[model samples]
Target: MALNIVIMAAGKGTRMKSTAPKVLHKLAGRSLLAHVLGTAEQLQAQRTVVIVGHGAELVEASAPGPGRQFVRQEPQLGTGHAVQHLNGDVPLIRAATARALIEACGGERLALLTIALPDPTGYGRILRQGQRVLGIVEHKDATPEQHALREVYTGMMAAPTAWLKRAVARLKNDNAQREYYLTDIVAMAAADGVPVVASQATDETEVLGVNSPAQLAELERRVQRAQADTLMEAGVRLADPARFDVRGELICGSDVEIDVGCVFEGRVSVGSNVRIGAYCVIANASIADGAVIHPFTHIDGEKLGVQIGAGALIGPFARLRPGAQLGDEVHIGNFVEVKNSTLAKGAKANHLAYLGDATVGERVNYGAGSITANYDGANKHRTVIGNDVHVGSNCVLVAPITLGDGATIGGGSTLAKDAPAAACEDEEALSTTSAARHRSSHARALSCGLRSR
Candidate 1:
């Protein structure tokens, strides 16, 4: 059977009190319309049409990809006219629920997705006569008794395309709101002797709609909790499920432990026995087996991803930017930052250092307060450190410079040129006795005072 999806996204969302379109508002890092489209894609629908109005241009431009057509609903009349058309508002609708609704339709009847909510205040009430579903009454138009009914329409339905067009054409705007209600088709279908079936949703959260900032926030929390639950069920230990968030796909191996206030985004993969500490934000990165990411670490691999090796120990406070690749047993300590660099096995940058656009060799110890000056005003360069090299504290190895095998750079040295293998390089300084220097400074100060007098 050929399935066509119509998404209504024309509402101005005055309740939201924002400039962006309501459907453009995001939940769990994706827009409401995006969620709907994702489900629609799952159905392999023949055509996906989006009816746009409020921010029509913006919405159309932001539409995920090609193959989706957009139609304008200028001076929007109501749900019926917009869709005359659509279900873009309900972002949480799952593909399975939609598939079930289609199956319930059986290509001959009207199948409306319904759910029983504890608070069905704003939704349309589902009117039923025993096994047969009669119609749906909007909350504003429904009577007191109808309002008390917990079963409500989920604003999602599957029907024969021909029957739906005929039913929509017969819809009249004689109701309280003077807008053509899409739910009115239910009563028409019942009158026409067409079987109106109800397909109950899996849960209330699956059909909840967002209309305000509070609702969006609530949905976000619900989504995060669901992700957390799934991770826990998969044997991942979360210190506080409520405090953790996964904005994108997170694939974890066995025995992974995530602490409170950790956020994983953009397709992160953690290996077995890995531990992520509290308040760490990791995106588009992969942490290998037995790696420990300490608290307050920030790793963001925007395009070129970061790779943390097996058994590596990273930061209580550190950052790993795009293109950072650390080998096995590497240690990146507090306040260290690595970008576009590759550190070989056993390399250790223990404190307050920066390694950008550099290649660090095996067993190298990058000392505290040391940095590779890889960027100049005009261009960027690379620093290469050979095997077993030691970069001393407070030293700067300006690119394009190389420290050869077994090289040792002394503390406080600022080297612009390359250093040869098995050599120790230090910045030369004029030595003076502290007492003599102090006496010379005192005599100069006395002479200056006498001259002034």
Candidate 2:
């Protein structure tokens, strides 16, 4: 039998006090409807239909994937009326608890996902008889005696497609609320000699329905705690589980240690033995093995990601923007920012520097307070530092310039022209350092030797 999953997301969420549809409100960086859709995708149903009413256009815009179909419930009747808009022989349920119900039903019988709540107010009570679910009574319709029942319906169920259609058609708006109740179908199923079952969820949090701002906040903390537990179970050490937040997927390899107050977003992957210090925000980046990301490092690889190579050390307070790539053993020190740049092996950009649209060669020393003047107002250009180039303090290398291999750039120099291989360029005091002089002589000798060859 093919399974059709119906996600009821038409509520206006008046308690949330927002113009957005209730389902469109975010929890853990994804809309509640998105989370339900993700679980629905896992079921691989024959068709996934979304019932939209309040802010229907906005809700439709969010989940407009290839396999999704939408039906509008204009004037927003009730749950029974919602399902009445569907065709025959499909399992219909609310989106909030879709996963537990789908897993429990197995498409074999009519199953209601129920929980034993301490106070089951404002919910329908599940009626049962010796392992068989008889029906459910709404709190408004239930007598004071029935209201004492602990097991309550979670607004989630699965039934035989044809039987459900017949049952819903027979529904009447005779209840206290004067609304056609979907729970009425439970009694109908039992009367027709159909087996009604209940799937009990162990965690009430998983079946929680968000109806207000307070509920949304409660759900967020629950989700974060679950994510923290999952990572710890997989051998990733978290300093304080309650302090970690993962708004998107976080993949951690063996022996990864993340400190408190770290927030990961948008598909970050941490390699084996990587240590992330406190209060770091990393998004859409890859941290290679043995790399250490010190405290307060912010890496946001929005679309084009940042990559940290093996054994690299970055930040007590550094920012790595999109397209920043560092090779093995590279060091990016405090208050430095790198954007759209590549630093090769053993390169060090230490303290209050910026590298933008630049390519740095192996063993290049980028000094403190130095910057690559890659933007010239109208356009952006590139700066290339060849192997073994030493860039001194407070220097600015204008874009479309190159510092040749074995060359030395003196402190406070703002060089707009290219510096030749093995030469020394300084705005002032170019003849001071013996090491710079020796490099200039050796570069000249090497050039002559190469010409003779």
Candidate 3:
């Protein structure tokens, strides 16, 4: 059977009180509509049509990709009107649930997805006679007895395309809200002897819809908790499941332990025996076996990913930007930043340093407060440090320079030229006291006929 999926997403979401379209609001690093479309894609639907109206241009532009068509619904009406020309707002609708709905329809019947909720307020009550579903009554139009019914229509249904087209065309706007009700098609199906059937969703979360910020937040936690549970079941240890979040794909090997308040974004792979401390944010990176990522570290490899080698130790306050590659046993200590740099095995940049556009050799000790001045005004350059090089504290290695094997740079030195192997380079300027320099400057001003204040 040819399947066509229509998603109704034209609501203004006035309750959300935001200018962005309701479907555009993100739940787990992806828009709600994206989640629905992903599920639809799994169905192998022949056509997927998205109804857009509120922030139509923005929504259409921000859509994930091609293959899906968009139809505008100006002056956004009710859910029925939104999908009249072609749907529900359930972001977590699983492919299995949709398949069940389609199976219940069987190309002849009207299959409505329904759920039994503890609090079914604001939902359409499923009117039934024994096991047969008669129709659905909206919350605003139902009687007091109907309001007490816990079983409610979930606004998702599957019907024969021919019958659905005919039913929607006959739908009238004479209800309590003066809007065309998609649920009214239930009564039409019943009257036309189309055998209206109900397919109950087992999981309430799978059918829940987002209408406000609080609802979105609630769903976000639920989705994150589910992901956390899956990771834990796979032998990954999470300090606090509620405090962890994975916005994208996270693949973890055995014995991986992640602490509280950590966020893993994009695609991250953690090898076995990896320990990630609390409050770390990692994205688009790979951590090899036995790596230790300390707390408060931030790593984001946007296009060019970062790689942490085995037994590497990274910061309590370190940052690894795009193109950072650390070799085994490397130590990047507190407040250090590495960007587009490669540090060989046993390289240590401990505390308050920046290594950008640089190649650090094996056993090289990049001193505290040192930085590779890789960027001039126009272009960026690279600094090369050979094996066993020792850089003193507060030194600046200006780019387009190199430190040969076993070379030692003195503290407070700024070197622009390359140093040969086994050489000790140091700045030869005599140190001057601050008071003497101040007095000398004042005297020079007086000699130049400029009065001192």
Candidate 4:
């Protein structure tokens, strides 16, 4: 028996007040329907079909991967009608129907995700004849007695496939609302002597449907908390779970430390012993072990994912854009920006600066307030600096240039072409007490020696 899953996501989302389809609105970097489909995937469904109406093309593209299919519903009809539309796609889907079947047939710890509210208004009531579901009655047509029934239909169930097919066919639209009701299947199953089991969730957030931006925001928070719990279980220390947000993916290794107010979007992986400070936004990036990202740093890997090597230290306010790769022990400090650049081991750009489309070699000391002008506001170019080279403060190294090994640059020089000077161009001045001066000169290699002497 092949298992098939159908996701009802064809709603126009009139309540959402947006042009986007209801389920197309994202939750945890994926559509709400995608979340449901992901859960279905967990169940290992042989076939997963998404019902698309509004933004049909976009929805179809979102989940057309292996084992996933799409069905379109024009002029969106009722829930029962939506199920009927999938007749050709899923055969004998009774297992997708009611809770009773799951309790008797599925796993032992099987449970339902539902919640009751003080105002159980505008919802379909879950009707049970004894321990079995008789069917469901809608709010618009429910009698005074039926209206008193508080248990509402969650539009979610898992049952024997044979029963689900039969129940769906019996839905009726001969009521006040004149809308086909899937809730009728519940009563139909119960009357036919089918037993269904159900469990209730304590929080209403679990069952709340998103029909608007406000609702979407609330659901996003809940989903993020769920993700946070998973990380904490894996031994990751999160300072404040509520303040953390992950829009894409976050894969954390053991003993990772994340401070409060960090936002991780796109795809990000953090290695062990990594420390992400407060208010950091990292996207589409990978940070190796022993790396420390200071507070308020923003890294957007975008199309080209950024990679920070082991022992690297990024700024409290640095921006690492697409294609930025920092090697071991690379230090990028406050207010610096790197794009399409690779900083070799021990390279340090410790103040306000920019490095673009550049290749910096080992032990290269990039100066403060400096930049590699790799763009002509039209075409991009590259700048190459060899090992042990030293760049001076406030110097602009224009692209298509190369600074050979031991080459020294002068302070405040806007170099459109490459040249070399004595490696210790400023060794005399470096002997001064100011470490900043040593770090900002071509004699950067003498920094440690100057300190010792």
Q: After superposing candidate 1 on the true structure, give the runs of residues whose Cα lies further than 4 Å from its correct spot.
A: 84-86, 428-453
Model 3: lDDT of residue 317: 98
Error of 1 at 283 (Å): 0.6
Top candidate when judged by TM-score against the true structure:
3
- Counting clashing residue pairs in each candidate, in order, gives 0, 3, 0, 16
Candidate structures ordered by TM-score, highest first: 3, 1, 2, 4
Tens digit of per-residue lDDT, candidate 3, span 337-432: 999999999999989999999999999988898899898889999999999888878877888888999887767667777889867766531122
Off by over 4 Å in 4: 84-122, 143-148, 158-171, 190-206, 420-453
**Candidate 2 — what's its lDDT?**
0.82
TM-score of each: 0.91, 0.85, 0.92, 0.81
Q: What is the C-alpha RMSD of each candidate to the true structure, in Å?
A: 7.1, 6.6, 6.8, 7.1
**Relative to the true structure, how large is the alpha-carbon lDDT of every model?**
0.87, 0.82, 0.86, 0.73
Better of 1 and 4 by TM-score: 1
Point out where model 3 deviates above 4 Å. 84-88, 428-453
Ranking by lDDT: 1, 3, 2, 4
State residue 189's C-alpha deviation in candidate 3, in Å: 0.9
lDDT of 1 by residue, 1-453 (tens): 877888889999989999999999988777898888888888887888998999999999888576789989888888888552137777888888888888998889999999999999999999999988999999999899998999999888888888888888888999898998988999999899899999898788879988899988998999999999999999999999999988888999999999999988888999999999999999999999999999999999989999999999999999999999999999999999999999999999989999999999999988899899888899999999999888778887889998899887767667787888976666531122211222354544332222100
**Candidate with better lDDT, 2 vs 4:** 2
